[model samples]
Target: MIRMPAEWETHAATWVAWPHNRMDWPGKFAAIPFVFAEIIRHLGRRERVEILVRDAAMEARARGVLDRAGALSANVRFHALPTDRIWLRDSGCCFVRDGDALGAVQWRFNAWAKYDNFQQDAEVAGFMARAAGARGRRAGMVLEGGSIDVNGRGTLLTTEECLLSKVQERNPGLGREGYEKAFAEHLGIRKVIWLGDGIRGDDTHGHVDDLSRFVGERTVVTVVEPRRDDPNHAPLAENLRRLRAATDQDGRPLEVVELPLPGPLTYRGIRLPASYGNFYIANGLVLVPVFNDPNDRVALDLLASLFPDREIVGIYSGDFIWGFGAMHCMTQQQPALAVGE
Candidate 1:
């Protein structure tokens, strides 16, 4: 049987692609590399960090940032892999463990159905599967890593807006049942919990990572907006309602905890997706995104209670979110090969 492990499980390494596309971040490319380095600093301390670079020149520049941040390069491996964008979570390979060996599901990516320059990003999963020495299976579904979250057990979390909606529709005719069938066959997920929608300003339709995330086996930390005037209030509240009534693969009630959304972060008038739900869970740390909002500490404190065994660290992602993603969007974890692989 194949299973997608939870983020808290031990990882062989965390994968990150170097940000070299200035068009994605616009005028803020200068600071994005440093943010990646700071994230590598925390992740390198816990597990091996594999850095993907387009070329030697890019590797040298990434090394400079890692050096300045005092990140240990011994375990930081660099790959000469070129990518169109830095959102590797959506483009990278999704790992599944079968017994002791790790396998990968190469989910097709259409650049979130919003861009035509996604040809390079579409083939990333095949490359990643080769790098991990794992057998790869094609999912044949237009899916992104940010669109789904799993409990490493049998339950998978996603959103209706991302996989099933007509607006920014992916896999044109693939409704909930079709998508769920594909997930079960490819990732061995027995249950899928679908939420309403994502936060406003999300370019990937509605990625669940920006709205809801599974923090434990049967517990989730979802974002909520209190003000009715805000655009995100109704959608988040509706998702919270769905989560409260949802159950896992075993029919157990889910313990849903509400995470606060950071204040609306805008650049020139465009509101970037700046929610705290995009945090990444590593071996011994949870890397959260903060937009300099007053609720940054509150979000961190709440996560600390849920992840008491691990250190909870916040990374400033105001400039990075201009591309509309954060720490979780930039990284993907490869679970450690279990015993007897």
Candidate 2:
């Protein structure tokens, strides 16, 4: 059985793309590589940090940044894998383990149905399969890692606004049932729990990683906004309701934990898609995206209790959010494979 492990599970390595595209980060491009270095520094302590750079020159540039952050460790490696953009979570390969063997699930990537230059990004999974020496299984559907969250067991969490939207139609003619069946066939999921929509200003429509995430097999930390006047107030409330009512594969209600949203963060009057929910779970640490909002400590405290075993570290992502995403959007985990089936 092919199974995608939970983020909290042991990882052989965490893969991320080094930020080089000025267009992706706009005026804040100069500072984004430091954030990547900070992230690598955190992940390298526990596991390998595999970074994809466009070329040798970009690798040199990344090395300078990592060196400055004191993150130039042996576990942090660089790969000359070019890409159209830096959001590797949506464009990178998702590895699944089948007994003792590991393979890559190469889902179709179309720049989230909103960009024109995604050919290079679309080819990343094949490159990843070759690099990791993992077998590749190409799916006939379009899916982004950020659009789905999973528990290693058998259940998944996703949003309707992302998978079934007409505006950003990922896989045309594929409905809820079609997607549910595909999840089972590709990722070994048995239950698909769907939420209504995502928070506003999300470029990828409604990626679940920006709204909710599974902390364990039965517990989830979903983002909620209490201020009724906030744009995310109603949509997040509805998602929470759906989650509380949903059950796992064995028919048990899910444990829904609330993570308060950091008050609205806007850059140049544009509401950046900033969320405490966009946190990455590493082997011994959880890298959370923190804005300058007062809720940064609050979000970290709540997560510390939920993930008692792992150290919770907050990365200042105020500049990184100018790219419309945070640390989680830039990474994909390769679960550790066991020896002998």
Candidate 3:
């Protein structure tokens, strides 16, 4: 059993899949790689960034974007691989440690509640885990990185909307107890703190990253929308209530910090799930997604307060969210724990 660490202090590296699929972004696909490049640039300044690309051509294209953005750092590296989409946080390997040796728990990815074609994305875990110097162990259970949040101590945060939904068919026969045992054995988690639901307009069937994230050992920052008439209002409110009542593995109540949700940003007549709560904590900086909305400043200010030691920078996410996710959804972190340190 291997337990994944918290993102705040973990140190292995960051993984990202370069955007290449035209169908994913429709008429807007050309702009996504630049967004990914910006994110990579931010992460490269802190720790190693391992980018997955389909081939040499894609790698060159991605590199060109990074070079132009001046985001190319010595720590950035590329792995030429095949992928259907660019959401690495859902399909990338989830690294854990057994004392000093690194291992990976391969969760079954079903395209975020079986929403899209994911044949290549499903095989990405093994490919990425092996590349990162971890022994890949197939768990054969349906899970996504966005679906779970870890507190580094033994608690995990998740929602019923994503993990328990029948539409995903990832955990068909598995119940709560079964999932608990599986998580304990695979990811080394001792407690699973379940929330009720996720915000509306989330396409991944309620990834926890869109709703709540563990900012500290006993604290979580979640998105809150007070508009009662809005579709996301009630669900997020309920999640906030649950977070207030939930406790970690040590039986301590979580300190909940509320982040304001950006006013609905629509493109092509579709409401994109733009959120500041989807920020990714890296080695030296916190990469946050910033929509070109007024709340961008407020979200950045609040995140700066949460990550007092790290540099918090916001990338324009107005164009990125058209693909249905922001920064955290596009990358996964590999903890830097060595064997038996």
What's the TM-score of each model vs. the native? 0.98, 0.98, 0.96
What is the Cα-based TM-score of model 3? 0.96
Pairs of residues at least 3 apart in sequence or in different chains that clash in candidate 2 = none
Tens digits of per-residue lDDT for model 3, 95-186: 88766778888898878765668989998999888888887789888788888999988999988877677866577778888888888988
Clash totals for all candidate models: 0, 0, 6
Q: Candidate 2: where are CA atoms >4 Å away?
A: none
Cα lDDT of model 1 by residue, 1-341, tens digit: 78889988899999999888899988888998888889999999999998889899989988988999998568899988888998889999898896567899899888998999988888788998999898898877788999999998889999998888898888998889998898888888899998888888899989999988889999998999998999999999999999999999999999999999988788989988998999999999999999889999999999999999999999999999998899999999999986765
**Over 4 Å off, model 3:** 338-340
Minimum summed lDDT over a 10-residue window in model 1 is located at 96-105
Candidate with maximal lDDT: 2
lDDT (tens digit, per residue) of candidate 2 on 197-258: 99887999999999999999999999999999998999999999999999999999999999
The TM-score, computed over Cα atoms with residue i paired to residue i, of candidate 2 is: 0.98
Error of 3 at 294 (Å): 1.6
